[model samples]
Structure formats: C-alpha cells, structure tokens
Target: MITATPRPSATPAHLRDASLVDPLRVRRAGPGDAAALVALSEPFVRAGALRRRPFDVYAARAADFLVAEEPGGLLHGCLALRVHPDAEPGAAAAGVLYNFCVARQRQGSGLGARLLGAALTGARAQSLAALFTATTGSGRLFLRHGFAPVPQGLAPRAWARTLDPRRGARVLARAL
Candidate 1:
C-alpha cells in the first residue's frame, strides 16, 4: 500500500477554497496507480494539452508522481516532479513539473490547486533548487503559484531539447 504524507490545510490566498465544495487528498503514486494515471492523462494528450507518454514511462516513474484522489478510490488529478538526471549531490537539485492534469469534469474545482501544492511540497522536501515546466496555453495557474516565464534557452538542456517548436510551449520556472 502507498502511504501519503498529509500536507498542511493552508490554501494560497489567490485561489478559491476548493475544499469547501469537495475536499482533496493528495498522495504519492504507487505501482497500482499506473493504469489509472494513464487513463486520467489520455484526454489531455488527445486534446494536445499534454504530450503523450507511453505506459512504460508512467510505470517506470510512478514514484515521481503525486495524485489527488477523492473518496472511494476515484482519482481526480495528477502531476510529476522529475528531478534532473545530472544533478550532483550537495548542489541545488533541479526538477521539472510535468504531465500535470486534472479530470475535465473537475477542472474548475480545487483539485488542481491541491495537486500542485502537493507537488511543490514534494519538491521542497527533496530540496530542489528550481522547478520548471512548459505550457502551451495561458499559464495563469502556474503564475499564481510563483512560476515566472523564462526563455526556452534557460531551461534544462534535456528538457529544452524535447520541446517541439511547432507546439510553441512557453517555459516557466520558480526558484526554491
């Protein structure tokens, strides 16, 4: 069984109180959640909201993810905090937050915020010096969470190499 570390209930003042409508519980993704994670991410992939990652990728990196689940094992959202492969010990670790998705039905709800908060908390716990991400649309949610737009050249080389210029993804980063 995968255990989740409970995060503080404090919500960012800029965001709505999603807990008032439907509270969320965020937890680390376990082996069993692979299929569910892929299922939740499919719609975003189809809509071009996110890149398509194979099942093997999700399975291999399950430990790097955090999921927001509702009562009765229903998963509402998920995100991945991928640490830079070249990060050296004692140096500021770098990571990228990617594959973030919330169910279409629950988009307006607070599940996204809860999931993001959990990811940030996880990054902090890991002592990451910076977190980065790419978005194709307006980045209001990320901006609200302290992320600022940055040039693609400033992103980690590995991440920047994966960018498809045609998609026009805007890179953003936040220093911890």
Candidate 2:
C-alpha cells in the first residue's frame, strides 16, 4: 500500500534541504485547520500568488487540504487537491492542485517539496492518471517534479475552463 506520507528520499535534492525538514510535519488538514489554512495562504493571496477564498470556503473544503504544521502551532505550508473523474466520456481520473503555499521563511526548505510529495501520493491513492496545476510564476518547482507545460486544450476540460485569462497563468501537468 502507498503511504500518505513521503519517505525522506522521495523528494528531489534541489527542492528540499533534508537536514532542515521533518518528514512527519506534513499532515492532512481537518476542518479545525480551516482558519490556519486561510491564514497560511493569505500572503500568497495578497501577492497574487493564489486566489482569495473566504473563511467559510476554507472550512467547507478543508477535507481537500493538506497542511504542514510547526510544533509551535503554526501552519508552515499547505496544498489542496481536487479530484476530477474524467475529461471525456472515458478518460482516466485526474486531480488539480491549488492553493499551494509555503511560509516565506519556510520556502526552499523542503517543506514545499514534502507537501507536494504528499499530494502526489494522495493523487495516486485516488487512481488519478495525471495531476494538473496553473502557476503565474516560473513553475520551476513543478518542473523539477516532472510536470511539463500542457496546452489548456489538452488539460482536463472541466478544470481548464476555470482558468482565468486575466491571471495569465501557465498550465502544467504531470502524468502519473
């Protein structure tokens, strides 16, 4: 069986500094984590790194989130995975990752990689054929994890339709 947590060696060298991270810090988020999730993603939202979602939205979709918590009761990072069954009548299942953010102090410390690794595991658990994401930045992290540019027309239909032209985000996908 695939474990939900990432093994130390599963992360790429460039993405995580193993000596600075705790593999166990990343855990599934519960409804109780809603507010923290919102707070954690707030900076990204303000910087246009992510879209804004209110508190109730976070509470309602808490099940879709995975969060990295510090021993001091702070959320250091978070990522959400929304599974979409198919793009066409017979396409394989797939998932879209969103609201990905790591505390500014925590960036480049492997917490983000560990979070991504965990979400990849979750996607596999759901029998997903691919994982997709839209990013406004260089997407270097996604590239290191094997994601490549995907034409919007080739991405999951339902999910692709939601992409905002105003954001000018690039679409990327990694097939499982």
Error of 1 at 119 (Å): 1.0
Q: Write the per-residue lDDT of candidate 1 for residues 1-176, one digit (tens) a residue.
A: 99999988986675555665566688899878999999999999999989899888889999988998877888889999998854455667688999999998888776778888888888899888889999998988999999999998767789889989999899999998
**lDDT per model vs. reference:** 0.87, 0.88
Q: For model 1, which pairs clash? A: none
Q: Locate the minimum summed-lDDT window of 10 residues in model 1.
A: 14-23
Give the alpha carbon lDDT tens digit for every residue of 1-176 in model 2: 87697566676766455635564387888999998998898999999989899999999989999988878878999999998887378778889999999999988777788899999999998889999999999999999999999898877789888889999999999999
Look at candidate 1 and tell me the lDDT of residue 8. Answer: 84
What TM-score fits each model? 0.84, 0.85
Question: In model 1, which regions exceed 4 Å deviation?
Answer: 1-23, 85-90
Error of 1 at 47 (Å): 0.5
Residue 83 of model 2 has an lDDT of 89
Report backbone clashes per prediction: 0, 0
